[model samples]
Target: MLAPESTRALFTGHSLGGTLSPMLALTLAGLGALKGEGLVYITVGASPGNKGFANIFAQTFPTSTSTCPETGYAVWSKNIINSRDIIPQAWCMKRILSPAQNVKNIPSIYGVPTIPFIEFVVFWLNANANKSHIMYAPLPITSCWASSLRRPLKTWLSFWVSHWGITMHFITMCWV
Candidate 1:
């Protein structure tokens, strides 16, 4: 049992775990197991949820600079996203298709003709799984975009690296 006044919870996760962390935090907060002011969640590469859930979560744990009596800091959550990473943009129809569309617009540098196929797959997935009305709206927390270099090759490499490895390392280093 936790005394809300004294107990501070910091929930942190990457990728799919990122998607779950805030949900868990919200559950705990709703159950009166933790106080909103004392709860903080930091997530990277988090998958998107429906706008309604995002709104409720944001209302439950709003981002504030005001100090908490217990922790002396009152940032309820931080969503760190890599700009080039597609994971964070998923599950939302418009967002899921935007990257694919962007790729389709780009001329194939290597003449490989792979972008069309990739676009087809993305469209298929979005059509099958994404709900039109359930758009993604991120929590009203302090969010940061860790953007990679703009060049094509570098962007591609950095996207994979940031999503798979560097983002976690950077977060870990911040704590250490």
Candidate 2:
């Protein structure tokens, strides 16, 4: 829908979209209808896995035969990530880029206030001996979940108490 003359620019999805926007720009150039100039991509809470895909995708674009116009194209890719957000903070795009590429990391605070809950989920499962090694048991698939729901209250209490002190600080970050 982006005609060369009529099209101003484009945008993509939240996390996955950030990684794919650059590739879309390259495709536009290959079609001969769009130049690389004035392309902009902004990703929030983006995933690091995209870095590997983007590096390989850019190489496939027509680099030799059709160089980006000398009009000084502006390909602005901005990634705004919350410090507590585990997904985007995990990977480094700079490590993947070759010497020729320039990518800057800008730190920002945005989105909801929430602790890293995954850690607690893991803790609860591990502390309960009955719950631990859940995969080892071969109970009827339907019965497994039903049995878990009926686990003794003491087991649940012990699991929470064991990790409560340790995870308190982790949970506070969600509020602070």
Candidate 3:
């Protein structure tokens, strides 16, 4: 994990590492690294073997804690996952354990509630604002479902066939 004042990009490994990257991004943003024009991207791999990571992330710096370094600045953050990646499976399990649990802090404005994650993620993806904030890359590189989207596609059929000892890329597509 990068220090609160570091200028480096904060990335994490699969599973818990992936979860940590975004939390750190939020922390840095709260401290002001992404003020109106900063960028942060977290690419999570596959690691669902650990638990309690998300809780630690959510409660890391509670609202009651001291203000972050850039409390006044806005930051841009994104989460990317491969469509066939099993690491996200762990995230799904985590969610099941805690449903409807607010993932991010919601600020009160004129008595209205604000969801920062939605605002940054869902909205940004819908707009494709210059580039997608989160990219879901489908697997097999060539299947009905894989070719169905407008995302970039590459030919990994041979690799997939050799990797899983299967003739079709369909199976691996699920983990892409």
Clashing residue pair totals per candidate (backbone < 3 A): 0, 0, 7
User: Tens digits of per-residue lDDT for model 2 on 1-176?
Assistant: 44656555654445667545655655666566564343434344243334444444434332221153332222234343333333343233242332222111112112223224433443343344223232121000000011122333444356458868755664454344
lDDT per residue, candidate 1, 106-167, as tens digits? 23322333355445645655554443344555554333434433465555455547575754
Worst 10 residues of 3 by lDDT: 137-146
lDDT, residue 122, model 3 = 30
Q: In candidate 1, which residue pairs clash?
A: none
Weakest lDDT window of 10 consecutive positions for candidate 2: 137-146
TM-score of each: 0.60, 0.33, 0.28
Could you tell me the TM-score of candidate 1? 0.60
- lDDT-wise, the better of 1 and 3 is 1
Per-residue accuracy of model 3 over 39-139 as CA lDDT, tens digit each? 33344433222334433333432222123424312212323443333233222222334332111111211113333532453333234322423222211
RMSD of each: 9.8, 18.0, 16.7
lDDT of 3: 0.33
- Tell how far residue 64 is off in model 3, in angstroms: 30
